[model samples]
Target chain A: MSIAEKLNTYTTGPDEQGHFGRFGGRFVAETLMPLILEVERAYTDARRDPAFKRELEHYAAHYVGRPSPLYFAERLSEALGGAKVYFKRDELNHTGSHKINNCLGQILLAKRMGKTRIIAETGAGQHGVAVATVCARFDLPCVVYMGETDIERQQPNVFRMRLLGAEVKPVTSGTGTLKDAMNEALRDWVANVEDTFYIIGTVAGPHPYPMMVRDFQSVIGQETRTQMLEAEGRLPDSLVACIGGGSNAMGLFYPFLDEPEVRIVGVEAAGKGVETGEHAASLNGGRPGVLHGNRTYLLQTDDGQIVDAYSISAGLDYPGIGPEHSWLKEAGRVEYVSATDAEALEGFKLCTRTEGIIPALEPAHALAHVAKLAPTLPKDHLLVMNLCGRGDKDVFAVAKRLGADIE
Target chain B: MSDAAVATHLAQTRLEKRFADLKAAGRAGLVTYLTAGDPDAATSLEILQGLPAAGADVIEIGMPFSDPMADGPAIQAASLRALNAGMTLAKTLDLVAAFRQADREAPVVLMGYYNPIYSMGVEAFLARAVEVGVDGLIVVDLPPEEDRELCAPARAAGLHWIRLATPTTDDARLPRVLAEVSGFLYYVSVMGITGTKSATREHVAEAVARLRRHTDTPIAVGFGIKTAEAVREVGAVADAAVVGSALVERVRANLDEAGKARPGLADDVLGFVRELAGGLTA
Candidate 1:
C-alpha cells in the first residue's frame, strides 16, 4: 500500500479521544490524563490557529534550518547498481540530527503552555543535544537523563549536552541504556510535574506527544514531497527510514502516507541477528503492551517485563517503536523489516566509501535495504531514503569494529 | 465511583482488623500478584476468584505499563498477558468493581508503575480507584521525592499510597517513606532486575528488620519471592508474604506454543498459588 493512502487510513488529525490508529491514544495514568487531554486540546487549538502554525514555520525555517536538502546519490547509485537513490539530508539539521525538528516544535509547545522546566531522555545523545540546544535557545532549564552506558559510549554527545547547558543526569538503573534513561526522565517528570515539560524524542509517549513529534518531523516528508517533485519531476517509488520509536520515518512518511503510488518501508535494528534474542527489532519480535505510557508493540516478556534491547548504534536500541508504526504494521500499510548489525555496518561503510556520506547507524539499516532492493528493482524505479543523521558520532565504534585506526 | 469513594472505603476498610485476624490465627497473610485482566478480564476475575480459596489474603493487581523496570521477566510477561487481554485503567477498575461485588474483605492493592496513574490524572485515578474499592496503590517508579503529589491526593481520597522500601534506601529516607503511608510497606527484598533470581540473601532479612524499626506499617516483601522456601524465609520476618514473578512466570512458561492460554490451566495456577501460600503460613 502507498504511504499516502496509509496516512489517510490512520490520521493527520486527532481521533474522538485523540488517538491515531489505537497506537497514539492518551493512555497515561489518571493524574497525567487531564493534563494530556489539556495538551491535546491545546495542540488541536494550535494546529487550527494560523498563528501557531506560522510560529512553528518560523522556527522551522530560522531556528531548525528547514527545507533540508534532497541530494541524489549518483555515485552510490552506480556503486550499488544502476537504480537511482536520493537522500533527504536531515543530518545537516541545526542540531546535526533530525531530532531538532521535533524539539523545536515541542519547545514551542512548552513555551505556549507556559511551562518553564524541560526534561528529556537520550540514548545516542542526539535528542538530548537537540532538546538541550532548544532549551538554551528558549532560555529554559533543561535536565536530560542519559544512561550511564550510553554516556560512556557517546562521550562526545555528553560533552555536547554539557555545552548546551543541559544537566545530563546519568541513569544508573536497569542496563543503563535508552529505556533506563527514559525511565529516569519519567521519574523526573512525575516528580516535577507542576513545572516540567517532558520533551519526548520520538513519537511514542502517550497522547499529544506521539502526534506532536510526528507533526514536527513531518516537515521532513513535506519538504521531501516538494523537493522530490522539484528535483525529479515526480515522487520516488519508495520512501524508507529507520524506525526507533519511528519519529524520523513517520516524519517523512506521514506526508506521503496518502500517496498510494509511493511505498513506505520502516527498517528496524536486528542487532546481531533477529533470532539471537539480542536485537532491537521490537515490531518484528515484540508483542503489544503498555509501556512508557502508550499501548504499542514492545520488546517485553510474556509477563510484561521489558527486555533489554541490543544494537550496534545507541540511537536504535529502543525496545519499542512508535505506536503509530505498530498500527501501520497491523494495517499492513507500511512494511516493517530489520537489518542485522553486520548488514548495517556494511551499509554504513559502503555509503562512506562510495558516496563520501557516513550515514547514521539507524539509517544504515534502511540503506542496507538498498543492497537488496536496488539489485531487484528496475533501473527506472527510484527510492528516497531519509538520511536521518550523520555518522560522525559512530566513527569510533565503526572503526573499532572494522579494526581501523582512527588516528 | 469516584477516587473519593474508593479512598473512603479503603480508609474505612478494616485493615487493622485484617491484621488482628492474621495474628490471632498465627498465620502470615498470603499476597498474590496478578496482572489486571491477564488472559483477559474474565480469566483475571477467575484468577482473583480462585485466590481466596487457594489462600490469598491480600491481592496485588498490576496495572500494566509499556515499560516495567522493577519487574523481571515473569511478572512482566503476565502484565503483557493482561494487557493483551485488553486491560486498561478503566477495565482494571471494572475488574475491581466486579470483585467488589463479591468480596470486600480482602484489601486489594493496585501495584504497578506510576506512569499509568500519572497519565490518568491523579485526582481522577484516586477517585476511580476509591470508587472501585481499591484499597491501596503501590507505584514502583514513584520515588519518595514525588510522593507528595501522588500521596496527598491519594490521602485526601483516603487511599493508602503504599511505598516500596528497597535495600538501597537509607535510614534517613525510611521515616519520610513511612510518614504518609498506610496499609503496608512493600519491601523490595533485593536490588537489581525483578525476575532474575538470587538467593534471598541475609541482607533481605536485615532490610525487613530495619523497616520494622521505623514504622509499624505492615511490611510485605516482594520482587522475586517465587518459591515457597523463599516465601517462608521472607514471611518469617515480613508481616505479609508477596509472591509474584514465580507464579506468573509459570503461567508464561506454560503458555501454548502460539502464546494462547491452554484449557484447564486453572489447576496449575491454583496449585502454584496454594503451594506458595502454604509455605508463607508454614
Candidate 2:
C-alpha cells in the first residue's frame, strides 16, 4: 500500500476520461463508446471482487506460469565486460511470450461481462495465439485479425491460432500491416458490439484499454522487484525493454516508476536507421497524432496521413506506441533510444551463442541497446532487460535474413 | 420559437439558418456528401460548385484520411483515390472556399476524423475553416466526452459543433450526444460505419421520436441510404436525409479502369443527387 502511494506520485495517468496528459482519450466512435464504458465498469467491479482476484491468481500460477525467473546472464555479462546483465525470462511463460499475461486477464474479464465472442488484432501472431489459447480454455468463440503481410511472415503462429479453434481473418487494407489489422478489428467491433469483447493486444487503445492492459501486465515488474531484492539484496540500477505498443515494457516499468535511483530505458525498433525515415521508432521519428482509438506519437506524413512503419521484426512494425509511453517520454521519466535492424541481429547472434537463449527479434532491439550500454558501465552495475519473447517463431525469418534457406 | 426550438438553437450559424429556411419551405432537405478531391481536385471542385444547382441543400465534403475506420468500402476507396491524387486537409478547405464563392446559400460541413485537424493545430485549422465559410464539423472520433478537445473550441469559433447519435445510443446516452450538437444532430441510422446495412424506417422513426422527446435539434439520418425511395422513406421521419456512400459510389462507378475520372463524372454525380433530392421535391 505504501509502495502504491509512492508510485502514484510518479504516474498520474488516464483520468476518468482517460487522458494521459493529452496523449490518450476515448477517441472511438459513438457506437463503441457505450460498450467501452460497459467494459470499463465490468473491469472495475471485477478488480474489486476477491473472487476475481483469486481466479486470476489461480490461473496465473497454474495455467500461464506466473513469476517468470530473473536469471543472471553470467556469460553474456562477461562478454559485455561492464555491467552485470540479468534477463527477465517472460519468454518462458505459456505461448512463449509475455502476451499471454494480458490475454489471460482480458479473457477473464470478457467472461465476466457475458461476452460470447472474442476478437483481437495481432502483428507477430504471438498475441493472436495467446488470445486463441485463452478463448479455447474458456470455451468462447475467437476471431483474430492479422494483416496479409504479417500472415505471410508469421505462418507458424497463424497455424497455432487456427489449431486453437480461432478464426484468423486476413486484413488486406492499406499497407496490410499491424495498423491496418487494427483498423479492421475496430470495424468488426463496431459491427458486432452486442456480443463481442475486443481484447486489445497491447497497452494502446481507448481509455480503459491502456489502463487495464497495463494493470494486467504489472505482474512482471512486481515479481522482478521481489526477485531482484532476494538475488542482489537491493533494487537494480537500470531497466531496459523493447517497445511495440509497449505492453511488456509498461508491465516491467510500472512498479518501478517511483524508484528515482533506478534508470529506465525503452528501446524502439529502427528498421534501417532513424535518419532513413523507414523505421518504426514512433517517439524517435514521429509527431503526436491520433490513431487506433488513442492519441499518441504516430509515424505520419506532413498532412497527418499515417505512414506504414518498417521493421525486420513484425511485432515492432506498428506506426504508433502505447499512449502511456508517450506520456512517459514527455514527462522524461524514461529514456527512449533506438536500435537498428543490424544491431538487433548482432545482439540476437551474441545472446544465442553466449547465453544459449535465442530471443525474439522484438526484444533483440533491447538486447542491442544493452550490449552497447553495458560495456560503458561499471562491472558491479546491475542492469535488467526483459527478454519478452522466445525466438522459435522468428527462427525461419532470421534464417532467411541471414541468407540461409531453412527447409 | 417554442421552448424546444429555442433549446435546439444554440447558435445563429449557417446550419440553423438553413434548417429554418427548409422548415419555412415545408419539406425536409437533402444532404449530399462527397470526398473533397476524389479523382482530382479540379473535378471535385466542379462537382461541389454544381451540387446546389443539382438540388443539394446541405453539402458535406469529406476530408480524405489514409485510414477511414468508420467508413465502408465505397468511401474508403474514395478516400484512397483522393489521397492518391494528393488531396490534403488544406486542399479540402480550399475546395470549400471555392464552393462558397459560387453558392453561399447551402450550408457546408467538413466531416472526417480528427488527426488532420490536430496535425494542422486546432486554432489554425478552425480559423481556416471559418475563413473558408465552413458551417460545421462532424469529427466521428470526437465524442462528447472529448468535447474540450475540438467541439467546444470550434463552436466558439463560429462553426457548428455537430455530433452523431448512433442506433446504439439508448435513452440514457442520447442526451450526451445531443448536448454537443449546436447545428444538426447526425443520427447514424445503423450501428456500423458508412455504406453498411441500414436501419428500418420504423426504427429510425421511433429513434427520431425519442430524440424529439429529448431535444428539438434538427435530426439528419445517414448511413446506408442508397436510392431516392430510401431517402424519401427516411426524410418522412427526420428533418433531412444525408446520403454519403451512395453519391460517392456514383463517383467511383464513373471512373475509368486506370482510376481517372471518365467524362461527365460531375454530371453523373449531380444527376444522382438531383434524383435523390426529387424524393422530397416531387
Candidate 3:
C-alpha cells in the first residue's frame, strides 16, 4: 500500500483474526467458536452476493422506513447560539430507533445460514422490539433475554415483543441489567447452538460480530454522508453520537474515520458522574479488559471482577463499550466524553422544547454533549448528532423523573 | 490414541505423572474441583489439603472471578462466595502454595477466566503460577486462536495448557483445540455451562472415543456428573471424572444461614469426595 493509503485507517481493519489492533478479537469459549465462524462465513458470502444487498435495500425502503430524514434543527441551533446543527433523525425509523438497521441485516444473514431460531439480549428493549419485528417478518421463533429490572422498566417493549410472538425471558442474575442479560443470552446460545443465531444488539461481542455489526449499521453514516453533502455541499465539520455497546456510534463514525477533517465525538453516559465512580463511561473511567467476548474498556475491580455500571438510560447502562470504540479511543480517532443523568434530562427537555423531537434517553446523552459543545463552536461550523431513538417508550420513566402527575 | 506427540511434550508435567500413576494402578481417576476461598479461607484450605487422601487423583482449584460466564449457577455462586470472602488471584496462588508444601504428588490446576491473570500481566502471572506449584491452567476464554496471548508463554514456562473440547467441537476444529494442549484434554460432557446439564453415557463415551483419535492426553469428562453413580458412569469410558458444581454445591449446602462454612465442613466435604472416588475403584 502507498503512504497515503497507509495514512487512511479505513482501507482495512480488524484483520482476519477479528482484531482492531489489540482491542477486538474472538476471545470466546470453544463451544461458540465454530458457530461464530459459521456466522462469519455466511455473512462474508452474503456480503459478496448481490441478492443480499437487494433484499436489504428492499426491506430498508419499504419495511423499516429507511433514509430517515436529515432534519436541520433550526431552533436547536438557535438555542445553542453557535454551530448549525443537524439531527440524523434515526428515531423516525420503523422500530423507533437505529437498532433495526443492524437487526434487519442480521436476520437476513440468519435466514441465509439456515438458522431457524433467533435469540437476542436487550437492555432498553429497543433492540428486543426490533429483533422481534424482524423475526415476525421472517417467520422465525425469537427469544429475547432481558434483565428482570429492565423488564420492569421497559414493560411496553416487553409487551410489544410478546405481541410479535417472541418470548421474553427475564434474567435475574447479578445486577439484573444489560450485562446480566448478555450473560443469559450467551448461555442460551451455547446450550442451543444447533439452530440458534444470537443477534447481539451491539458491536461489542467477539470478533466478526463487532466488524459485522459495524458493517450492517454503516448505512447510517453512508446515508448521512450523502444527505450532508446534498444539504450543505460538504461534510459536517463534526459528528456526534451516544454509545452503549456503541453500534449506532460505530455506524455513524465508520464512514468518516478516513476523513481527517471530520471530528468525531462519542458520548458516554455518566450516570451520576465519572468522579463519583457510578458512571457507564468505560472510556472515561474504566480501563482495557476483556468482557462479553472482546477486550475493551471495562469497569472492573483490581481482581478483574466486572462491576455493574449505573446509568439512567438503560440502553447506555453497560459496563463496557464496543471493541472498535475502545480502539478508536486509544487510536485518537474519536474524542470520548460523558454526560450526567441530570444533563441528559436537560438535553431531553431541550430537544423536546426547541426542535419538537423527543429523543430516547440514550441519545439524549449525545444531545447533552452537543448542548455544551455546539455553543462553543463558531456559527458557520456544521455539526451532526445522531438522534438515535424516539422517546415514546421512555415517557413513563421520564414523567416519573420529572415528578409529573400521571393518571 | 492421538496422545503420542502431546504426551512427549507434556509428560514432564505433574498432571501427566498423576495420570500415569492412576493408569499404573489400573483405575480411572477422580479429578475434584473446589474454589480456592469459598465461604472462607480456612475451610477451603482444609478441603484442598484433604482431597488426595479422600480419593481425588487430581485437584482443580478454581480461581474465582467476578463473572464466571461459562459456569452454571452452582459454580457461579461458588465464585461469588469466594470473591465476597476476599479471594484474589494472588491469594488463590498462596492457597496452592500452602497445599503444595504438604502434598507434593497431587496435581494442582488453576482454572478460571483470563482477565485476572491478564490484569497481573501474562509473563508475571505465568512465572507466579509455576512458582506456586501450579501444574496446569484451564482458561475457559482462551481458545487456540489466542495462543500467543497466554498458551504459548505458559507452555514455555512448563505449565500445562489444558484445553476444553465441548460437544460443539467438531472433527474439523478438534485438531486446533488439541494444538499446544498439554496436561489433559477436558471434554465438557454437555453443550452448556458447568453443572447445568448432564450428557448421556453414550454421548460421553462417543466423545471420548472421537477425541482419542486426535490426542493421547488423558480425557477428563466434566459438566454434569454429580453423584457416585454419575462418576462411575463417566469413569467407565473416560480416563478421569471431573466433578465441580457438585463439590461446590456441597460446600454451599453445608454453609450456615450467613453463608459461612458450618462446623465439620472439611470432613463432610472429604467424605463426599471419598464417596465419589469409590466409583473409580469400582
Q: Give per-model TM-scores.
A: 0.66, 0.97, 0.97
lDDT of 1 by residue, A1-407 (tens): 64444344455544665455555454443334345556777777878888888998998888778889999998888887756889999998888889999898888888888899999999999999999999999999999999999999898889999998999999876668999888777656544556878899999877778888898898999898899889879988998899888899999999887777888899999999989999999999887766776668888764455788899989999998888888788877789999999999999988999988888888999889877677777777789899999988888888888999985
Q: Model 1, clash count? A: 47
* Candidate whose DockQ is highest: 2
Please state the Cα-based DockQ of model 1 relative to the true two-chain complex: 0.07
lDDT of 2 by residue, A39-133 (tens): 99999999999999999999999998888999999999999999999999999999999999999999999999999999999999999999999
RMSD per prediction, one decimal?
12.3, 2.6, 2.1
Score candidate 2 by TM-score against the native.
0.97
DockQ values for all predictions? 0.07, 0.83, 0.77
Off by over 4 Å in 1: A1-8, A12-14, A405-407, B1-110, B113-282
Interface RMSD of 2: 0.7
**Ranked by DockQ, top first:** 2, 3, 1
- Give the B-chain TM-score of model 2: 0.96
